[model samples]
Target chain A: MTEATFDACIQAILKGDKQGLRDIYDAYLDYIYRIVYGVVGSREDAEDITSEFFIKLWQQADRYKAGSGHKAYLATIARNMAIDHTRKYKKEVLESFTQESDDDVVIEPVSSDNTEAEVIEDIAIKEAIGKLNPKEQQIINMKILSEMTFQEISDILKCPMGTVTWRYREAIKKLRRYGYYEES
Target chain B: MKNLEKEYKDQIDREVPDLWSRIEAGVDAYEAEKKAAGTAPSSTPVTETPTNITPIRKKNVISIITRITAVAACVLILAATVKVTQRTKSESAAPAADAAMSEMPQNTNEPENIQHAEEASEATEAPDYISPITEAEADAEPSNSYKPIAGADSDKNASPSLSPSESAVIKDPVTFDDARDDLLPQLEALGFKLIKDFVFEDSVDKRSLSDDVISDDIDIRVASFTDSKTSDKYYVVYTVNDDGAADILIVRKADNTGDILYTNPSYKNK
Candidate 1:
């Protein structure tokens, strides 16, 4: 959805355009999926949470305030929903992550030519992302995957922008230590 | 700004399986449940509003409902018009339909009201069926128990006393309402959404399709003359979401459907 369409989209959604919800979903699904999947570190739990997250979008579209960047707003909802899901099924999700093990976490060097598709290497990055605290994980993912600005991250997190950028910086250093950084 | 998006963007993280469709399914289920419960399902929004809807938002909600109601009504009328016109096309049906049309109380009823009054009047005459031919015939087919309707108003002469004969049809003066709800979905299913439908009081080439009638696919056409040659034309307009891209379709009144003249991608990306 375009920035200009926030009001129209919200109104259409409330008015029962499942397509309107689809439009919002089209715009932010990957972004939200990235956030939740980054944090949960399990594709299954992430899928379940992302599905519930948008089901929430349908039942609660009217709650969306006009003029707020829907990306930031939706990312926050996704982040919170994933956190709640992990907390509820913490043992199961953690056990699965630990069992998968961090042997995949050894990231390969970023090739000067960045065209290689990394299946295991991507898992390494996700596993590396999984190690950060929830807040740190979210800040970095929102910035990178969601293309959210530091200010919007701060607004969604309700923290200082300085803290958001700093946490993202620290998260990157941590991921680099985990061998996830692309030097090129 | 150094970022992971460009570097790892192309890297294959296991892409979620067509995630939107799954989310769409979830929404469909929620809506289905709300419908089954006899209460409308409200969607979930990311920003949390209080449990109680704010008064201003409440008004917005009411307006949304009203718009939907209006759209549904318009679809009903459009569907009715399509049915009646299509019925009139069949062989040997014209004279009776002419009777129905003449019997039609053209006295100031809105198109919808005229439609309902026609259907109600038709219902009074032919009590067996109220729906259109395809729908009725679908049920009527392969059934030994069913009797085919003789004419559009087969029972007109039988029910002499209740007849909405010329005078009675006039006396009742059924009033049709003009408002219609959003039929964007139906329009989309028809292959496009009508951004506008209207008669331009002046040269239409300069005027765009009116947005006021977003839900109305009602076709309006007029014949005029600049010298002696007749200048008759028809048009349809459609808009796509996001890009605000629209296409003006030149449609013939003989058929409600239109072909895309071309698309104007001017609505978005400004």
Candidate 2:
């Protein structure tokens, strides 16, 4: 998970070390997939994008210059691929799901022992996050979902550091207002 | 700040695991496919120099140079023809206008009024003559003539998107040329061919402009070369912003499976 270890795996991948590729995959696959899923908003699309991202990795493995945070780099690739997939298919996806009411739309609830409680909490939190401006939602997603640092998020969002910080704070306040962090 | 950061991090931790798993499976599948294609596997050892690699580099440089020259030649020819036509029009038309002016302007009594009327008439006729000439000149210009050179030139000025340390791996003096040369054809095989140079003003933030943004931005250009036969001719151009470390924006196209075919990551116009 450390940057050094990750870089080593990348080096190994470049050297055509199959085990290295697997190791890199094992370490960060979940992180990359989740980030893609967050953007694509569907498991199927997320799956496709994730696959494409890695295929890209294989093709351009030589191009992944080291010292660029390898995991961050991979995450970025996944995120872009997912977004592109969504854009390409947005019209079809929107039309297919148009029949479903907002209230009927069910997102997977967080996994925990308190399934019912967590689902209620998640709904409240998601709704609160949804209420925020689009920029805020993006900020939260970049910071939380993508695990991008403030600086990285700032670069991606093309905003001042202070602005990223403020948006993150505001989004958190809104989510907390919905009792997102209230221990049952 | 620390507390808030921690809280946000925890929230992300809770939401991310499930989604991450799905992406992992997708990457794995993609990697598996590349292995089957005999495209350099990620794990391919770098120790031995492959004999086939030499021709690929040479071919890439030649093709890129040829594409550039061809586009430049087309533009120059178009410009020359336009100039010739403009000269002919001016030669034939100016005398006619001058003769008409001389025949009408002998009286001095109403000089101001006459001059005003003549000037007004010339204003109306001027645009009429000039507009068509301009349009004709524009029409004579080959549309795709500027494309390849623009891409090639932009590649020269593009910022190094990868950090120095990262770039160092390929910077071995002996190998840099080889590496640069190797890059283009590998890209070509992916189904992209350089077409034009473009400057993208990325107002999107650094966080939002993740590698995904990089890929998607490139894909937008890729999608434009819509020919099914050129599906294998993927082309990409990339350039870094002059002022910021805002990573280079590459325009790329891919083959049918959407694999990247061409990339010029350093295609910023100077």
Candidate 3:
């Protein structure tokens, strides 16, 4: 959706219009779901968190300042909700998941009732992503799924922009090595 | 690659069930919850109290501490000023009093009259001390009544984590008032007169500091000080970024260059 339309939807939501939220949900459900799914790696958890994210947006619509990048705003909230969910329920897995930080963004292959060929291809991509450490997987998810800038990702991750960029480059390199990406 | 990104997004679209219905239901449930709790969600902004209480508590603690410190400082300054004024008044009045006594008839037998005169003078001068303390109390009262950044209270009520602009008020390592309080004296001592000091509530579009137009999406505090001798101006730009890092720079008006007076170690290490 265009920034103008997104902003209008936020304004509408602020004014207590459900249609505005519906418009936003219709526009960005896949976008938010993809980011959440990428972080949590469980379809059920992703669904739960994605729903909570929208509800959160509905509740906190007034907090959104007009003219700020709504996509980044959505991505930030979606990603945070997903991470928070992981931290809440899957603490043990997270404790051993990474020594880097508490943001244990584990991207396992999600089992879905898709055609075998599609499932296989999806698994290949998931496996490729899963090969990297949790941090790299997170960088890949945000960069690819949400198309967040390294700086935006850095802000979200509380890491330096230089480190974000370097990690993104490393993740891309690893993906290339896994034969998923062709060098441009 | 774009293909990988597209595939990943598309796969999620195909795999993850649309939770819009559940989300819609969740919003309905939230409204109902608010209604049951006796809050009309439509009229009042619904605050998630569980997450909000901590930060508001923290803000209250900080605000109270700041108010107490301001009142204490004001009291100390007033006390010092009163002490100096009293000393000066006694020193000036000594010679005049001696001359007046010499011009008067000897009153050694009427020491009670002298005591009465001194008591009257004390009674008259007592109000001056009382008035300044009252003025000092008046001055300290406004510290508790700062104009909060626009929507800042609501923002604080809404979320534990602050938005970029909102965090400018909350998460800055050193706030504008604190910086001004500390730096103004140092700047004055360095022979600089404060020209203008203000905060950019929104992201500055293009603030020309030392010929450089800064358009970063960070809340900035700009304090301009003029050199007392040269009348040359220096701009102190204190930026509080969204990531909770802050920086302060001093830029010379003539040179069009700035020196980093302070950088948050988090920012510098990053």
Each model's lDDT comes to: 0.48, 0.47, 0.56
Best model per TM-score: 3
* Clash pairs detected, candidate 3: none
Give the CA lDDT, 0 to 100, for residue B264 in model 2. 24
Global fold similarity of model 3 (TM-score)? 0.40
* CAPRI category for model 1: incorrect
Write model 3 residue lDDT over B134-193, tens digit each, in one string: 223333432221123555454322333334565346455455566555445333322233
List model 3 lDDT by residue over A73-177, tens digit each: 898888778777877887654554234442433333434432222322324666777788777787777677656677766665666677667777767666654
Candidates in descending TM-score order: 3, 1, 2
Q: Between 2 and 3, whose lDDT is larger?
A: 3
Off by over 4 Å in 1: A91-184, B1-5, B9-14, B43-270
Off by over 4 Å in 2: A91-139, A147-174, A181-184, B1-43, B46-270
- The DockQ-based order of candidates, best leading, equals 3, 1, 2
Give model 2's TM-score versus the native structure.
0.35
Candidate with best lDDT: 3
Clash counts per candidate, in order, are 20, 47, 0
- Chain A TM-scores for all candidates read 0.57, 0.57, 0.64
At residue B229, what lDDT does model 2 achieve? 29
Q: Using lDDT as the measure, name the better of candidate 1 and candidate 2.
A: 1
DockQ of each: 0.15, 0.13, 0.20
